[model samples]
Target: MSTAPQGTTGGKTGPARETFSSRKLFIISAIGSAVGLGNIWRFPYVAYENGGGAFLIPYLAALLSAGIPLLFLDYAVGHKFRGSAPLAYRRLNRGAEVLGWWQVLVCCVIAIYYAVIIGWAAMYTWFSVTKAWGDDAEAFFFGEYLQAPEEPALGFDFVPGVVYPLLAVWILTIVIMVAGVRKGISRANVIFMPMLLVMFLVLVATSLTLPGAMDGLNAFFTPDWEALAHPGVWAAAYGHIFFSLSVAFGIMITYSSYLKRKTDLTGSGMVVAFSNSGFEILAGIGVFAAIGFMAFTAGSTVEDTAVAGIGLAFIAFPTLVSQAPLGSLIGVLFFGSLVFAGLTSLISILEVIVAAVQDKLGWARVKASLAVSVPVALISLVLLPTTTGLFVLDISDAFVNQFGILAGALVAVVVLAWVLRKLPMLSGHLNRISSVKMRTTWMVLVAGVVPVVLAYILVNEIIAKVSEPYAGYPAWMLNTFGWGMSIGLVVLAVLLTLIPWGSGSKDKHDPEYEAIRAAEDKEEAR
Candidate 1:
């Protein structure tokens, strides 16, 4: 159907949906979405903590057997159905529309907290010049900078420093989202992705020249070959790859929905997947190298200094900046990379929600962008810049990521593959025009292997989180932000699915899709 030539259309009610001007732009944009802060700040720690060099084996296996296959699955559904996540799933099977809304609500929770991190990175890029976190990096980060109080108690006391930067970040995000597909997303990818690669390359080179750099390198690469036998290690590999690639949620599906009918989806999936992993490897090198310098200064080991997420970005790297030669340069490049990588991923996450709203309400791109994003920005502003913001971010991230993304993904594959039985049709759509074919092998991976990995990861997460209060927060905080937030998304998703789609929804009976289906049907009959 994808390969069929164009013909007359009959069902569209509004202007044609936007498309990527070229496949090159689509690939760049997809890679931009995939390569995010986790690549720079989180992957190195995951690799080191998992199995050092031996982690690559499981990571590669997970990428091939799960990540890429699931990516292809997302591409197939979005391209074939020609709609946003809810719309696409609705088109696939009416009962499945709830899954789409589930993914969108997940993005909503993610977007609210995610922007604050990006804002932090943007500010730190400048603080690098002044060495603002003087003396004790930890004290400054927690005390003067974040102003986070000792307890996890509730408060709306906004820190002016964080509020200003966060406001700037939201404004920038809204401007890009309002610009529409080609003008907004594709162009940002072209500008930001290249800049990210080059800046990160320089950061890596500079980190390698730091004193004790070889020690960090050795620690990072010294395969604790024994670690490979652990199922937990392999599970970590599979779990991180899902988050790293930005799959299972709605990001990839919404992005692919904008492609031209005959796009080379599977081939593009391969490029995006490998490129994302490649960036992760580079990040491990640079981060560990910097960690080595920190260890050298402290007369400790790289293992002592190595950390991930907020601690790695704000605390560890700041200490490195104060001590190492060319430290200021390292801080600038590293935080700058975070800013670029973070913006790209945040843009993609928000698009999943905005596009879903657009499809349901049938609004113009600008109206939809403002309607959805303004409320999102307001929520983020009100909730996340306060003194207790970090606690909320941490607890919410633990719950939402595990239940919303991991559990939600598990549900999607099971329902689509086992219940509705849609993989065969989606596979056919991929094989029709994709340079890489999806036949029995792709089917087995998506329908059989992918769900099992997701389910294993989900169950383990549930057990661990339920068994203990995450990050040692009080019961009230965990119950409100973590459990309550995840459950609320599910309930809202069901309610959203019940509402009728608006008249302006272009794909209610998509003419482009039907025309191609009819042409392919005629061809198949012949």
Candidate 2:
């Protein structure tokens, strides 16, 4: 075992690891990562579809039992091991390095497709001004705007509108990553997260003023007690929580690795978890209020107009923008929020890859950021920003998230908790530095409980995807992008771990890691 001061690693052993300058920045940055595209566009509809107000019970339960618990788990591992995912897990135990790579590759896949969605949002933010979709929103989106082919082939017929903004997004991401953690991530979150919040709040306020806003609010909050009795709703809560908090995909692990040694690990986790959830609830309010207004004007039921994902954001909202008074303002606010939220989350996702590369290659921060991002950006530009990109985006997101992130997470908890039996050690690390101490209950939940839920989710997803073609795509298409991509990620990750680690990573040499190991060894001997 070895020991040395942190933040003292000088040039060329890889740029000295950077940290969030304060707990406040760390918390804000974490929130920014967590409150992403899913929070704004996906959550409102998820809550609405699942029991509405009653869904909160299971949602809160999932947050407490799994979300923050897993949050603590990531913080303890990264902060204690004090490196990127691969480095930290390798330091945890040589056998565990692959888990980190799996997560990094997952982030890489996500970052590429994620940028294109942000590009769409950025374009729509401009489209808001003139109600560009005009009389038929769906027609404009699918036909004139995207110009997606009648068939979803992996085509390279580039859509200039989509490519331009996506290119801009990648360029901006490169600049930020080159800025490093404090200057890049922290500052981006500090600026953008608040702007996102203020903008969304204004959106919600304006949404509330729409003629039938209360109807939407009522629809959102009105609880169906029966939905709770079904297990699927509970599963949905846990599922959404996992994605919403950006766990299991290496983002939190990498982010937590940047935290100061003496930081309040659990306290910060709490702030991030709650703030993300609060923002989600607020998003539900804003989205449904507008939907309610749309329903009112169309003389239709709320359920008829309510939708989620791309439909809600592009098709439905654009229609609302066409109809609502000061319509353009609402569109700007909503789409701007999406652009900001997506960027914050996108940068965080890419950082997992950037940080891992920096640690693995022992490259300087700027070198690693460019080395990782440029190739990734190039891949995104080639694959996305084309006629069939939305299909690619949808399928890649579905399979990668389910198999790559969800399965990787399940494997991580099982290995760390059961196989390696590291929960005690990891829990001890948290209790030592955290404001809120970890009780044995934390171990039970992380080890005994969360895995069961994750296993269920993962199994169901696999069964469903295998049994039926995802999104009704051609079998070959699904096989190539959907199944092939997910399976390839795991194989690639294992291969990546075989590459030799850089000497400059040096996290294993951290004094704190040595101290923790020494204590564990002494306790075992005793």
The Cα local distance difference test for each model comes to 0.89, 0.89
Q: TM-score for every candidate vs. truth?
A: 0.97, 0.96
lDDT of 2 by residue, 1-526 (tens): 0123442244433355678888898899899899899998899899999999999999999999999899889988888787889988998899899999999999988998999999999999999998888899999998888889887777789899898999999999899999988888888888998899899999999999999988998999999999999989999999999999999888889988887677789988988999999999999999999999999999998998898899999999999999999999999999999999999999999999998987887678888999999999999999898888889888899989899989999999999999999998888878875788997999999998899999999889888988889878998888888899988998998999889766565552344546656764575566
Where model 2 places Cα greater than 4 Å from the true spot, the runs are: 1-13, 507-526
Candidate 1 global CA lDDT score: 0.89
Q: What TM-score does candidate 2 reach? A: 0.96
Residue pairs in steric clash, candidate 2? none
Clashing pairs in 1: none
- For candidate 1, the TM-score is 0.97
* Candidate 1 per-residue C-alpha lDDT over 357-463 given as tens digits, one digit per residue, 9 for 90 to 100: 88887777898999999999999999999998989999888899899999889899999899999888888888887788889998899889999999888888888
RMSD to truth, every model: 2.6, 2.8
